[model samples]
Target: MNMVNTQVRLAARPVGLPGDGDWTVTEERLPALETGQVLVRTLYVSIDPAMRGWMRGTPSYLPPLGLGDVMRAWTIGMVEDSRNTLFAEGEIVTGMLGVQRYAVTDGRGVTKIDPAEGPVSAHLGVLGVPGLSAYIGMLDIGRPREGETVVVSAAAGAVGNVAGQLARIHGCRVIGVVGGQEKCRHVVEDLGFDAAVDRRTEDVAEALRRHAPQGVDVYFDNVGGEVLDAAVRSLARGGRVVLCGAVSQYNSENGVGGLPGYISLLINRARMEGFLVFDHADRYPEARARLREWVKEGSLKVVEDVVPGRVVDFPRLLLRQFDGGNTGKLLLRVED
Candidate 1:
């Protein structure tokens, strides 16, 4: 019997927020695996803010997913068959599995995941790039000290949630900037943030003043633009700004620009630095060990909002991340 694979591909470069017309879905027969490759049956698919950037034809840290190409995504899957010595049938793995029901990846590119350690979805989240981003940005770059205050935008998001909690672990007072009151409550009540500012209902800068009276010592920035401007204005002396993602500008037609406030950095003696998660690939194990330990100890929360159904739903599922429909790590459940 021949194996069948369903997939979603990029049909066109999106001009703005991608609509249904931007994608195409098809089913194809799986070909035999070649040497150094393994056939994977996808279980979970990650829908991230970065996907918006991938839909455009432009120069970036990584090349854009071309038109008619399988939509690129990090996925957790089980090995259906293997032609590589490193991978075996029935083993679970995670990597850039694309938006598909089945994928063949060279063993070199994939990472084996043990579900016994944590939820397999986590391999695409806290134990994955988003988690690693939070870890490296906080510990290596921001270097939150005990008794300092840390403020993060997109505080209920995947990276922001972890960043806030990790800052708190270092004995910093942590405040989160979220979109709504419910998300604000989640950040504070569920995630243990000292306070959460609802950007939709509250003045972010004023909220920062109330929550962080001493001014921010560390700013773990996620949404740039106005939020970044507000954060800069509220910074303490010698504050470190750990620049992660700029979801606010991902879908913009014009060039992305934030508040014109370079003078604030000079006045506050603040440092702003941007980083990609892959830069610390060599130290993933170090971060992974600590994150897993935190999860096991109930100190770190691993939240994944999973969208169940077929791979054809990928394009629609991806847009949800931008709309703030997801609370934590957004994932597409490709298989039962």
Candidate 2:
């Protein structure tokens, strides 16, 4: 019997927010595995903000996903069949599995992970790039000091959630800026953030003043728009802003991100730095090991919002980030 693979491919570059028209889903027969290759059946797909950026014709850290190509995504899968020595049938693995039911690879970028270590979705999240992105970007760039206040935007989302929590673990007062009251509650009530500001309901600059009275020492900026402007205005002397991503601008036609007012940086003597997780690829092992230890010790928590469905749901699901639909690390459960 032949195996059929379902895939979501990029049909065109999106104008602003992607619509269903931008994607094409197709089913095809899977070919026989080659030597040193493994046939993986995807179980979970990571939905991320960066996907929007990758869809555009723009400069990026990685090459844009070409039209007619399978949409690139980080995923966890089960090795159903293998001709590779490093991978075996029935082993759980993580790799760039794309938005597909199955993938055959030469085992180049794949990593074998024990499902018993944690939820497989977590490997795409907290224990995965989301976690590493937070762990590396926050610590390496923000460098929060004890008793200092750290503010993060998109605080209920993946990177922002972990970054804020990790800052709290470093003994800093952590404040989150989210879109609505519900997410605000999740950040403070459940995630232990010191306080949360609802961007849609509250005046962000005033909220910053109230929550970070002494001024913010570190800002882990995930959204780059008006929220960034407010954060810069609230920065204390020598404050540091680590630019993890500009999710808010990924779909913009013009370079209009409501870029932060500059005088504040000079007057406050503050500094802003941008980083990409790909650059720190060398330290991934270290970050992974430490994150695993913290997770096992229960000092860290991972919240994953899984959308149960097949690969065809990916296009609409990607909009959840912009619509404030998902509460935690958003994931697509491709299979049982």
Candidate 3:
């Protein structure tokens, strides 16, 4: 088949937030699929805070993208053509398809998704990495008990919102710490969070005191820096803190900001741990089954903030993740 592929390749390592000079968008002729390979036409690409870390040249959980390489991203698309017998033409699939209009893979990381299970978008958000992150990190790590107080930072986001709701389902009192009044209202009203602390309008520490007088039993932290420090001060005895992501310091030229001290852990016998979604990849099937049940039963709600654009517009689109410019999981729709 003859076709042109549009893609954004990393052109430079960004010091802070990624910009235009950081990537080169070009159109090239699509290569023919060989044995065991499949061609995917990207429908949606997930835009995440974790992508910022993947861009830095410094050592991280995953290797950084090399210059002129296709920008890394998780995409949900249709199998346009396939030499792999496992996948059929027109089958919906999800994988690390990168920032491109089309991707060719050997089916190494690809997973077939059933539209009958849910909407295709659900594969990118709820049943995808974000939902898995919330499930394993919160349940396995946080270990919230009935009537315990659970607080989630960046609570209106894709992972954080699901983490909060999962805590509530386990019979815990959930408090969501979001940036604005609208997010606060939506988190509490629309998503069934017990309470929401507006970081932009209210003092987070004071709000925690009012909502969780006894203390925070579990903290699902998405943002570090001051918000983390404030949450630390409210920990109850034997509390657990799940360190999911640190969007607050992703762009800092200096070191990422962190807890003022671990005294809360020492004093309250508390524990704080960092969670990477990939670490629990083996259990994804188990988690996905539960997520599917909840979503189908209408107990779990997934939110997606989709922006309209193509590969050439991805650099500017990434900036939205850094500035709290979008709510829930942000995605760039490469095709209608």
Candidate 4:
């Protein structure tokens, strides 16, 4: 018996927000695993803002998704079969498995997941890229000292939420810039942010000034554009800015817009630096160990917004990230 694989492929390069027309779903019979190959049954797929950037027809940190190519995504999956010596059958693993029900790989980038740490889905979230990104960006780049003011944009979202929480753990006064009143409340009341700025209703700069009168010492930027400008303007002397993700600009035709408040960096003797989580791959174990400990000890909250659906639902499910429809790490639970 052959396994049938369902996959979501890129149909067209999106202009702004992607629609149903931009994707093509197809099914294929899985080929037998060759030497060093593994077949994985995808369980959970990570929905991230970076997917928008991958759809663009341009050079980025990673090459753009090709027309008709399997949509790239981080996934947690169970190994159904394996010819690779390192990966055994029935093992759980996580890697860039694409938006598919089944994936065939050489197990190069794949890592076996220890379920004892947390749920397998968490291997794609708090224990995965978002968590590692937050850990590295906050400690290595942002470097928020105790009592300093740290602001995180998209603070209710995956990376931003973890970054904000990490800042709080380090004893920094954390403020979250989010959309809507409910999200604002979640950040402060639930996530332990010192304050919240509703980017939808309030003037971000003004709100930052009110919440962080001493100025923002560290800004963990996830949603760029206007929020970035506001954070820059409110920077304290010798401030550090960690350029994580720019979700706000991902869908724009013009790409990331210019930052008008960048001059504040010069005025305040501050620095702005961009980093890729892949660049710190060597330190992932260190980050994951600490993050897992936090999650286990209840110091770090693990919030996941999982949407149960088939592989065909990926296109619509991805829009939830941009529309502020998800409050935590958005995950597509690939149900049969």
**For candidate 1, lDDT tens digit of each residue in 1-336?**
298888899999888899888999988998887788899999998989999998899969888788999999999899999989998899999989799999988876788988787678888889899999999999999999999999989988989999999998889899999999899899999999999898888888888888888889999989888888888889999988989989999999997885786677999988999998887888899999999999999999887788888888888888788988889898888755
lDDT of each: 0.89, 0.89, 0.89, 0.92
* Candidate 3 stretches greater than 4 Å from native: none
63-133, model 4: which lDDT tens digit per residue?
A: 88899999999999999988999999999999998999999999988999987756888887788899899
lDDT of 3: 0.89
Return the TM-score for candidate 3, rounded to 2 decimals: 0.97
On the 0 to 100 scale, the lDDT of residue 186 in model 2 is 94
Question: Which residue pairs collide in model 1, if any?
Answer: none
TM-score of each: 0.98, 0.97, 0.97, 0.98
Lowest-lDDT window of 10 residues in candidate 2?
A: 255-264
Instruction: Looking at model 1, report the run of 10 residues with the lowest lDDT sum.
Output: 255-264
Which portions of model 4 miss their true places by more than 4 Å? none
Expressed as tens digits, the lDDT of each residue in 1-336 for candidate 2 is 299999999999998999988999989999988889899999998999989988886668878889999999998999999999999999999998799999989999999998777777788888888888899888988999999999989999988888998898899999999999999989988889989999999999999999988899999999888999889999999999999988888888887566657678999999999999989999899988988887788767778899899888888889997788888899999854
Model 4 global lDDT (CA atoms, 0 to 1): 0.92
Error of 3 at 35 (Å): 1.9
**TM-score attained by model 2:** 0.97
lDDT of 1: 0.89
TM-score of 4: 0.98
